[model samples]
Target: MTIEGRHVVILSGGISHERDVSLRSGRRVSDALIKAGARVTVREPDEKLLPWLEQHFEDVDVVWPVLHGVSGENGALYSLLRALEVPYVGSRPTAAMLAWNKATSKALVKRAGIATPQSIVLPNDTFRELGAASVIDAISKGVDFPAVVKPVEGGSSQGVSFVNEKAEFSRAMVTAFTYSDGVLIEKKVTGTELMVGVLDFGEGPFAVPPVEVVPHSGVYDYAARYNAGETTFFAPARVSEAVLAEVSELAVKACQVIGLADVARVDFIVDESGKPWFIEADPIPGMTETSLVPLGIQAAGLEVSDVYARLAEHAAARGPRNTPATPNLVV
Candidate 1:
């Protein structure tokens, strides 16, 4: 579809911890869409956003929300868009909520015969009421050493920790709890970290070439994710042909299993034995200068602007799917 005269709103920069990253992503998307001959607006979500959107609803073709972390990924923004009878890119609100929760999504993927790290979910109240010391003892006995502790629902590794020894377990749990009321502790799997980007674009979902991330400090934390030189990325990842094919196929299946549409990034940890273990899926992936989605798109022999423009066009043409019905007259 032609996007020559399309008007798109790229919503970004919400109250999430990844607000800065989202802003950068919105800017990149806006520039890309403009290059594709579409009128673009980069708007940070605020109190007046809904009113403004309602006023200009007919003028806009679609809304491409780049709000990362909680602000955008939690499904509220998408739900609001649906309520407004506006077309938008990415997954529906139900799918967004399912994918945003790491533990829940992992469970769903595992049910589809995917291998994921064994983990436990603990609520803040449960941990505190049960006594931290006792809970720690139970966790130590249940989960193996060298585990990963992170919030149940968050991105950009905001409050993630790697626990190598039992002594470091408490601090890791405490750090994770600071970010979310629910925390996930999984037995850390040793492997090469790989990321796969999937693009549906109205057709059946297909996986792009995988990208291998090599963090300078051995941890892809928030700083390493956003900072330009903090990590070195390899497009068409340095992996065996077998590994690549398996990872790519798994990525597409993960998207289907999680009910994601449009675009998503599935992270995996290929163990030393060459087995891919599903980590998590990001429905609203980062599209900043250092993000992996753009790299994946480029690796697949496509331009970022063209891909985004096509997404906008496809969404606009589809119109609203879950728009609410009007009330009946009381006569």
Candidate 2:
């Protein structure tokens, strides 16, 4: 499956808060591509991304966009990739844009009849124009005290907070607003935190085994994400086979409904009722040492190198399918 001499660019490093982590992911992915024997180049994208690629896109066979959040995940770079006519490894421009914004994603998934926690989107100006009371009341009416507040467009749980008091709500909103223009307030479904990996291969998208995330302290934050031991991920999650099957099916449904292609990691919160609620869809996800996508792939007994090689092949040969994409191959 190796592309051999074909040049692949791993796009990373943006103006987002996750830039450092994205760079680390780019390094790891580049190393894997090198081991897989594909000529690899690492590119840090900004407004100059297009000009930079125009200089090299002709020689590039495909792009493995490792960028997370905003410009990278929201189709900014993917659009450029399309204009340049280089096949990229992750979700398409339109799909990535659709999935990156929390409000857009929630609406689409809810329309698909998936169980998402009660939530509301509030822009910073919306709060400024009105007041914090209205925003807090909106959250209070839908979600009770123990609530989750986060930036609508963020990664690695960068601006996420667990609020247990009304006094802390303002702080949480301010925190999230620093990362994004808007925030989403969701009812904290405290039970099991599971991440289901979805891989869209040549045949179609197949749901890989679920992974249970045990965060050391304040949930899965930036420090907990890249700091390794801060979080423990159990593959094939400890849930029963029936529950696993149900969760996997739901994960695949979420991916398809949101227009995601390539690979996606669907985050879910299983409530006391055993119902899985969609938290959000991670389009680019991550591939650093602390990332869960690579861990899930390895847990399936496939080498990381082989996964990258097959993924390269998948990227080179696959198409952006709104329907079933599980062509004839499975990764």
- Each candidate's TM vs. the true structure? 0.96, 0.92
Best candidate (score: TM-score): 1
The digit string of per-residue lDDT tens for model 1 on 8-85 reads 999999988889999999999989999999988888899999999999988988999999988899888888898898
Question: What is the model-wide C-alpha lDDT for candidate 2?
Answer: 0.80
Give every collision pair in model 2.
Answer: 202-327, 203-325, 203-326, 203-327, 203-328, 204-325, 204-326, 204-327
Per-candidate Cα lDDT values, in order, are: 0.88, 0.80
Please report the TM-score between candidate 1 and the true structure.
0.96
Question: Largest lDDT belongs to which candidate?
Answer: 1
lDDT of 2 by residue, 158-215 (tens): 8899999877898899899989998998878888888887887667787878888888
Q: What is the lDDT of residue 215 in candidate 1?
A: 94
